[model samples]
Target: MPIPDEAAASAAHSVRHLFSRRSLHVPGTRLGAIALPAPIGRRHHWHYWWQAHFLDCLLDEHLRDPAGNALSEARKLARGIWLRNGGRWLNSYYDDMAWLALTLQRLDAMEGRRRPRRRVRVLGDALRSAHTDELGGGIFWNTTRDYKNTATTAPAALFFARAGDFGRAQELLDWLRTRVHDPATGLYLDGVKADGSAGGVVDRRVYTYNQGTVLGALVAVGGRENLEHAADLVDAVSRSTADDDGALPLGSSGDGGLFAGILGRYLALAVSTPGIGARAAATGRSLLATTAERLWTGRMQAGPGVFLFPPRQEGPVSLSSQLQAWTMLEAEQACR
Candidate 1:
């Protein structure tokens, strides 16, 4: 079923309003950059990863309304990310660096400017360095190399795809399918820990973002099989992750808070893919539409545009959740 244009427009409007209301100015950043608050208690420090997502949101807004100040806002956030990270885009976590690199690439394309080549090279090197033969293959979650999880690998795959390095992206995806994919579920597991051995301990937990990132990777790679697999994952997640009331489950605070929205981004991609079957496209659309509807009805803050996830103990209203909500809305618009 087609999403009513009114629903899409309302969500977009709320996103703009939420952004204007909740986005906060971080001290010492460039003129236009702002940070959204994390959960209530730890809202003190900005979640660095969320800032990367923020840039993506700004880009989406800019594309939707080019005359708006979205471009300037994105540039400010990019500068703020640099300044806040001690004048470096590279971070301790390879996955984090991968996300920043991908976002910067998008910013560069939109602005007709290039990010420093050295920064891209260093970031790519760090991500590639983290790949090991552990658990039969996949990138480690961080410098510790203690585990290989989808949280890290999926985004790394996306970064590789965006860089026009489909060889590496496919390699990562193939390894993930072999090592951690749950065939029965048509969903990828979290990851496994390995010490240069076969079959390390596996997390086996399902996360919306992991499926989402792979969907995004498929979008970039654009093979028939990849699109088919992406559609399968979309259907699987729709059936498994959602509750009886039609709302997708919120992962948790911190990283989890950002999960559904991440999935929403790829779900949108899947629906928009050329040659997508009507059934698959409808599955993706229904999932996003219901999730957004439930979220808006159940979680909207007393303030006009703000939204708060339940089980408030998670922290002050999280910037991560805010971004997640906005991403879902942006995605809904994309699907239409």
Candidate 2:
């Protein structure tokens, strides 16, 4: 079934009411709160990466309907993030910075301005700096740099590709291909430890978001080999990660909640990007449409005019989980 734009917009509005809040209580603070519900204590937490995804979703809403106020909301959230991060954008996690940089890049692109270029450059440079010879040449996960992982490197590659640094992007993707790709499952592994405790040991854990970001990076840095790999990865995800009903695995609350939606986001990208193969495109579209339909059908009313999605239908509603559902709906809408 086709997912309508209204459904996606409703998902966006629901999330905004339930989770989005001003970064601070002070006057003129742009909306930027990502918190739990009242039942869950409504505590405000600072998750740099989650805020990045929230901003991206706002942009998605704006793009879906240009006449709406979502752009204004996105601008506020951007400012809120900047102010909340102590008037800076750099963070300890390379992956977090990369995600924010990507959304900022999109904002810049949509507005036809380079206003966020400086921040994007700062993030791109930080990602570049994180790439070292350690652990077979990939970006480190955090500032401590004890491990190199796809969580950081894949998105970093995507950020670089979007920033017109194809060379660096290709370098990062090559590192993943050599060090992190698991031939057995046709999916990428998590990361390899570079610390003394587990030096050079591969994590071997396959995550939905990692596959999504890698698919995005592959499509962004398009070539015969990369496109072929992208097609194979899509098929692998459809075969391995999805249930018979086409619903991808819903991760736990907190950061894990965004996993399936992240995969959905890039799967939508694969569906739209040219030369990803017709089979892969169909696979991506079917997965997104089916999963989004399921989520929409299963949504529960939290209160009057407040609808939220549980983590997996039985789990508690968190900012990440609700955002994940919204993201999947948006993905399906975009593909449609």
lDDT for each residue of candidate 1 in 176-273, tens digit (9 for 90 to 100): 88877899989999889765557788888888788888888877787888888887887888778877866677644577777888888888887898
In model 2, the runs with Cα more than 4 Å from the true position are: 38-44, 114-116, 195-199, 312-316
Candidate 2, residues 118-216: lDDT per residue as tens digits?
A: 887788789889999887799999998888999999998998888778998999999999988988889999999965642488989889999999999
Best by TM-score: 2
Give TM per candidate.
Answer: 0.85, 0.93
Clashing pairs in 1: 37-319, 38-318, 39-315, 39-316, 40-315, 40-316, 41-316
Evaluate model 1: give its TM-score: 0.85
Clashes of 1: 7
Clashing pairs in 2: none
Model 2, global lDDT: 0.85
